[model samples]
Target: DDIAEAVISLEIMRDRATAHREDFETLYAAMHGLYSWFLRVCDADGKEYALKQHEQLFETWGATLSGEQSLSPLESAGLTQESVGDVMRALSAASKYNQELKEQKERMSGAALNTCEKVLNPLKFLLSNGATTARDYRVVIEKTLSDTEKALSTQAQRSSLARLPMDELVKIQFRCLNPALAFRELVGENGARSVILTSGTLAPLNSFASELGVDFPIRMEAQHCVDMNTQVWGSIVASGPSKRVLNAGFKSRSDWAFQDELGASLKEWAKVVPHGMLMFFPSFSLMEAIVHRWR
Candidate 1:
């Protein structure tokens, strides 16, 4: 049966990890077993004989989280066992990081993992199950975007990172649906409080509907920009002689020696802008090089 195969797969992992059974690898494998078992039961087309063999599993056990599934998670979550394992590890690390963040001192490595976990957990759950635990979706939205921002920040290229915040791009995946999970929940009381999957052109009343899963009817919406004028809208490029093509727009500010001058300009701008802006440096060591010729 698909269910048995799934469980066996996880158990094998557990057996290998018994030396450290409670280790992340072990817990992840266990969760994987539980999750994949549900998938096989819902698959009428996957393996008929196996589905029949384990159909009783669902009948005997309480309905698992059958109400949460989506498609994007399936694709983005990846398929290779190692890739899945790596992502799961990143997510688990992120979850631990988020929990610790609510308290005290932290692991720098975990900071990135925490955000990645937030992004992937809901996605993985949806892929495995057919419905999303709304809470997981929100977490994915939060961490995925944060990590994306962090990843992008480390890069010398911002223009290529795209315009939408990392969070929005990551969360865009929740729009995908998992039919089997939806049907499983619709069979009984284990379904969502309400689910309205429809389309409309004009709708955006709720404030957090997009963030929260509350926006009953998901659809495209018209946008209205602020009456206020653009305060600041620009771009940044990598700083270095070899990558000097970036000096096009800011010819006056282009001299490598003028790096300090740019910082001073930022300071001057900050006197009025307060904490609204941010200044990024390639590396702290570059401080001497940049400031020495400070523009």
Candidate 2:
């Protein structure tokens, strides 16, 4: 009976995969044509803008850099010190904005590659082989199908919007409402001897186990090896060595003063600490920004 049910499920999955593959092919062709149009438009705009004005501006800037010309030309052209400063700041902002766009483009490309490899390729192979059994590949097939369906939904919406004439694109987000289903899929069906989950933050063991839909037959709560009184100590560092308040709030976290003070405090600690020290940040981006500034 179970084998028959599995065969039925596999048949349904094959039908769905066939439909999704057709839709993806159509969208891919449309996007390719649209992208070609975009490239032509960008090329025309670049030639017009760069040849007319930016060419001269860049020449003047280069001359100034090489000490072959003075700021007098720019000043004579009605550009003041403040105006030049503003232009530099604007260029800096544009550079950062372009960098963010590049990163987003790379992430989207990665997602497309994952869908092709995990969903489309596997589905294609299964269909070609005329496989009827889902017992072995059930977990992989279900996960990939779910991912492809979600991607197709998002792509369809985005493709519709792309057909319209718009200056900015609307963002569409897909969030998982039931995280436990994903956890259950990982641990429920697949046969394994034992699954051990170890983490310092898994304090409420009962709730964690319940969420995972798994029972721990043997549980152990190990004590800290270091003595809290002598070997281990903790303190709240409200201010840095420079006496600047260590406020890691959203607005203050990015401030140069705060970063400098924090770095200075860490350096002092590193000098005194015996073996090593561990520093934690609220977020990876914040840590990256601080480290970039230091470098």
**How well does each candidate superpose onto the true structure, as a TM-score?**
0.22, 0.40
lDDT of 2 by residue, 84-143 (tens): 334333323433433454654322233332332332222222222122211112210000
Note the Cα lDDT for every prediction shown.
Answer: 0.39, 0.42
Q: Candidate 1, residues 1-295: lDDT per residue as tens digits?
A: 2222323333443455323334444434434543343343334332421222222112121121222232333333243323445556644653554455454432223433343344445444444423333323321111111333333332213332123333321112243233343344443466566655444423444643543434346455554454325754566544433333333232234354345445555566677775587655655655555666553
Counting only residues 3 or more apart in sequence or on different chains, how many pairs clash (N, Cα, C under 3 Å) in candidate 2? 0
Question: Local error of candidate 2 at 105, Å?
Answer: 25
* Model 2 alpha-carbon drift over 4 Å, by segment: 1-181, 188-194, 199-215
Highest TM-score among the candidates is held by which one? 2
- What RMSD does model 2 have? 23.2
